[model samples]
Target: MNWIWISGVAFLLSFLAAGVLIFFGKELEDLGITGNIYYIILIPLGFSSAAFLAGAMKSYASFTSNESVSYGKLQLTGPIVIFALVVGGGFIMPNFNRKEQFDVKMRIVSNDRPMTTLNEGTVTLYIGKEPKTVNIHDGEVAFYNIPEKYHNRKVRIVPAINSYQLADSNEVLISKNEDYVDIHVTRTKESLSTLVRGSVLDQKNMAVVHALLDFSSGLATCYTDPNGNFSLTVPLPPGEKAQLKVVTDGITRFNEVVTISSTIPIDLRIDKTP
Candidate 1:
């Protein structure tokens, strides 16, 4: 019996055992190794096991040829690290972290009515523990990449209200008695035009244009469409200065400020010109 043959068999068996333990050993109470520790130990066991198995194959191959078998740990390190990130543990961190977190509360009220729940709501933190309440529908809450310090904190949001009723119109009366921002989205206008006149040999320049009715409290986003064609009816927070942002085809086109009023119309034009 060749020692190399015996060693090969032993390594294979040990490797199989380690794999099974990793897959189904969650209840292995007495097996001092568990979780990451189990995997860490199995790492070295796996390498040694392979070395033994390869030693046998080499012993046979070497006698047939002058070539020598060579192995290195460097080859395994990259794969192990990648496996840990994608399979062993990193994937679960987001869900687990959310559950372990303490959340903040945001209160949102709208002018439409005292809705049991808001259509949207968000909190904006300028600094420290203090955060301002912005209506979710105003598009303020869509901001991502909140600093880590503000992560998991809750925001309070409220909508705007109208104070009086119109005499003879289908429009509902706005209740201004409550604290909220007044926001109404109406499609105002749309148009199309050319930025650059294409010659017989040039690419055609076409623009889809739109006009918008924008109103909010503090933030206002205003811009003509890139092609000067389209308009938007974006919700505004209740204040004098507000931020405005636009999205077309899942892309954020622009961000800026403007005074939001019932009188001014926001315009956007998306360029289709190549």
Candidate 2:
């Protein structure tokens, strides 16, 4: 038997199998196979395949050669060498290509000024359902070990503070190499209150006097004045959607969702019940 040829063939087969395993490792993980268990099962299968091929080749060579072949103590040398190389490389190669991790720093600001009063709060960064939260320190917070894939992707940053309307900013773009981000927040007299001023009118466009307006499931409720004008502050920040229900004379007039963007007055028209 040609020992060199057997060794070379076994090495080639083992190398190709290892490459396939590495390529599909992520897919395997998604299929609920963890890395340790995955490699544990696949590596032995690869090694056995290589050893079988080497043994078959050795048998064929022995059958074809007319001369009497002598049995050697190192008969399984080819398969043994391949197993050693595969197992050793599996442990050694990861050190050369470590996954790159990043640290992201965020500075909180309100009205274009760094917030000095906000010394205690948590800032959460979300990429889909995965959230990384950090406590604010000196108006700044940091997230560490952010994966490289999140770079250049859009992420939502939300601040949790008391007696303040923390705006959710989804326009934050995670830069490829940049680590610092600036977030602007809004402060309100109450927790995330939006001043909504609007008018209630009938189908005839006449003022609907004494009509009751409920904002955000009664978070803020009030009645329209004689001029059909109403004003209330709802507990919601800008760009948030809230339900607004209007009632007059024991009849539901208007029930729908509205986006709170500004204090600009909106007109709500409904048909009067006979």
Candidate 3:
């Protein structure tokens, strides 16, 4: 009975945790906790495994004891079974008879003209762990029968074209029904001109000149001028986050992630190196 109570408590706690994750998953994701579908399944399975082990230990102890084994001593099975059923049903019941599908439509344009480069390029759309790739045709492509589970979720669209690069707007929110996404690409030579301007300052509120700024693993790099101003273009679209590393006098002073929001100059302040 004591073991049963312990197992029951463990199950309840796990259930509560899973509930929080399910209900507030998006909020948690914003805070960097990747509460994806896998976590939802893993959490319950992990707790159930622990409960099963506890019950097994109790059975072993009882069998080895001088006291005769009784049916009442096996009560741990009740909560364990119930927990398993509830969890399994919660995940499995949703997929049963779920034939709903969604469609995602994409339109590609290059230099303000409809892109008809089927043989020259392909676009890949990623929803969670699933990736769908389709060749661009007639300036458009459509993905059909996408599982309804991904409705309203965010997706990443990447376009691969010979001598052409995506200009802007990659990540998009998938709609509940038919979704439409627009992508723009430009020639590689014409793409590198989107510049991001910024400045680096030290603890004394003074400009840190000669500071090296690297973005997207050196996809773009520049050093601060005498007045601590720097400008370099990155290969990422707007609204995408990139890793920004700042080195001053050959010593890394600031290393952080930054979101590419706009052309407005970004001001970064760091502690002066000793």
Tens digit of lDDT per residue, candidate 2, span 122-174?
Answer: 87788545676777888888776567888887778778865455555545877
Return the top candidate by TM-score. Answer: 2
Candidate 3 local lDDT, 126-176, one digit each (tens):
865657777777777777656788788877888887657778768777775
> What stretches of model 3 exceed 4 Å from their correct place?
1-193
- lDDT for model 1 comes to 0.37
Model 1: per-residue Cα lDDT over 50-143, one tens digit each = 4444453331122232335454223333333433444435335545654322222223333434534444433343433643333444332222
Better of 1 and 3 by lDDT: 3
For candidate 2, what is the TM-score? 0.35
**Model 2, residue 187: what's the lDDT?**
72
TM-score of each: 0.19, 0.35, 0.33
Ranked candidates, highest lDDT first? 3, 2, 1
Q: lDDT value for candidate 2?
A: 0.69
